[model samples]
Target: MLKAVILIGGPQKGTRFRPLSFEVPKPLFPVAGVPMIQHHIEACAQVPGMQEILLIGFYQPDEPLTQFLEAAQQEFNLPVRYLQEFAPLGTGGGLYHFRDQILAGSPEAFFVLNADVCSDFPLSAMLEAHRRQRHPFLLLGTTANRTQSLNYGCIVENPQTHEVLHYVEKPSTFISDIINCGIYLFSPEALKPLRDVFQRNQQDGQLEDSPGLWPGAGTIRLEQDVFSALAGQGQIYVHLTDGIWSQIKSAGSALYASRLYLSRYQDTHPERLAKHTPGGPWIRGNVYIHPTAKVAPSAVLGPNVSIGKGVTVGEGVRLRESIVLHGATLQEHTCVLHSIVGWGSTVGRWARVEVPPVTLTPTIPEPAWTVRASSRTGSCCLLSPSWAAESGSLPRCSS
Candidate 1:
């Protein structure tokens, strides 16, 4: 049997995804009509012989997360569990801390995924590669633009062998176009290196105070500590992919990822995309409207938009590349673009909410093709009662 482990960093990690993250855990936030990590769960469930999925993070098992787990367990029919770390254990530390549980049934191999990423999740290909030669670590690699590559864990590999020759995490200088996709397939033997890191940290703790004194000791950053330490040792390899992949670090990027996923639904979940009915909201491109939402026939929603539970779109309303969250009501002819309408928020008649679109650049959280937006995005956030007025000038907000 095989299993998968998702490293969902706690509340403290996704600071970039504010406001929305304030409402739901970043992983739980909706992307393409479903919670962000739901995509991950769906992808893992499709892999043959996948038995269990473990989510490792410091977030207390809150209601949303618990609900997601319960629902996912039923839907996937697998033991989907959450392993809460007592403290923030860097990416690798949680794996080491929960080593026993992971190795319990003696899984042939378990995949490790960073919760922030959005990808097509080519797991079976990695499995085939691992089976051909059981490498200790198999990292999914994808190419990024040369300038953007520096912001990620860069890898240089032997073309024929696919052996990771050198690894550097977020190097100041360019290393290679291929970067770690934050998705890894690790054989059971990979735990040995983690144990080694744990012991070394334990010994080093003796010199200081106690491992307990610091916030995290075994807090191994998988990129720097292990991949970098053992690259070219014949244990690490890369499986390059040209699949749909991006990181959801900010609201704008979330919007971007929604578009990507909505596009994918055409092939993988056509039913989720709303269709234009004889007397219903006219959908343009890819759109998802919850069954409970009420949209007027004259309203237009399209390209990339997700209307959540109980949302009411008034006549002539126009929504594009945005999410009308649960309970939000858009009065007659209101227009929302490149923005997210907060839950239960109301946009009065003729009001327009907008964010001037700009090319997304590589930055924090990760070099995600999307961006949290800089001052340009941060400056536009406006939630004033005055915004409801019928002003030709739109009220700007961060996407």
Candidate 2:
């Protein structure tokens, strides 16, 4: 029997996300009507022999994750366990920290994945590859593209054995087309190295030194540090996959993944995107506008938009290439494109929230701007209606 564990890198509320991260933890954000991490969980659950799923992260350790788990259970119907890391552990560290819980089945092999990846790789095939090689571990590999894999690490494998030869960090040059896909199947022995690292850290009174601890306090970035170090020691393997794969890292990446997810869903469930608005809004192909949502008569929605349940779209509103989370309100005459609106958030009336408006209609525009708040609470926002002649700074709103 084989089991799997998923390590959702904790609350993404750092400087990188800023204002957007303030309203909700990054993992909780909607990636095509579903939470980003939940997508990984649902995908993992589909893999043969994945009986249980575990989410480890450094959050309040209770509230937020619990709520997410409840919603996940309701949506996915898979049993999930939320493990709170008292200490922030890196990827490898977090797994090792919860080793006992993960290895409960004492299975021959287990699966592990990064929370931020969106892929259609066949997990069962990877498992078969692991069994065929009879190696200690198997790392999923994707064909590298110019845009990606430059910043990501490479998977150097023995061409004949398919065993991971070495794991190298972003080398700044075109190294290999096979890049680490942030997914893996590990034999029991593969975890031995992690155990050794943990013991080493315990002796030094440092969880990071332990190598199996969380990120902030632990030296646990698998690609940046752990896997690279382990590769030098020679115990890892790689399994190449021929499938769609993308890293949902930054805001830009998030938007791209959302569109991709919608497109994929439309492939299997076309009716899910069907809206009976008659002549209300201009919903584009593959958009998901929830039935519980109320779109005003004078609004224009979609090209790729996901309006969550109970969301209220005001009259004269124009939303394209955006996601409106559950219970959020879009005031009258607002134009929101290329952005994500959090749950229960209220956009002021006649506001313009986009990267930036352009002088031409069909030309490329700018990066969407948000209120810059120095504190954790978030920054003050402003709304500029398209009908208005001028833009003005608006008041600050709390999450």
> Model 1, 145-178: lDDT tens per residue?
7888987899999999999999999999989999
Q: Assess each prediction's global lDDT (C-alpha) against the native.
A: 0.84, 0.68
Residue 98 displacement in candidate 2 (angstroms): 1.5
Candidate 2, TM-score vs. the true structure?
0.79
Candidate 2, after superposition: displacement of residue 122 in Å? 2.7
In candidate 2, stretches whose alpha carbon ends up further than 4 angstroms from where it belongs are 12-14, 172-174, 202-221, 224-226, 232-234, 268-271, 276-280, 342-352, 356-399
lDDT of 2 by residue, 1-399 (tens): 677677676664244443445556777767777778877777777776666778777766456667888877776666788887776667777777777887787877878887777777468888887777676667888776655556678877778766565677787876677788788888877777777666665566763334534323344566755577777345677777776677776555666677777887866457667464676765656678777988887788776678888999988888887778788888776667776676677776656566543321111222445532121244444543321111212222333
Error of 1 at 74 (Å): 0.9
Candidate 1 TM-score to native: 0.89
For model 2, the local distance difference test gives 0.68
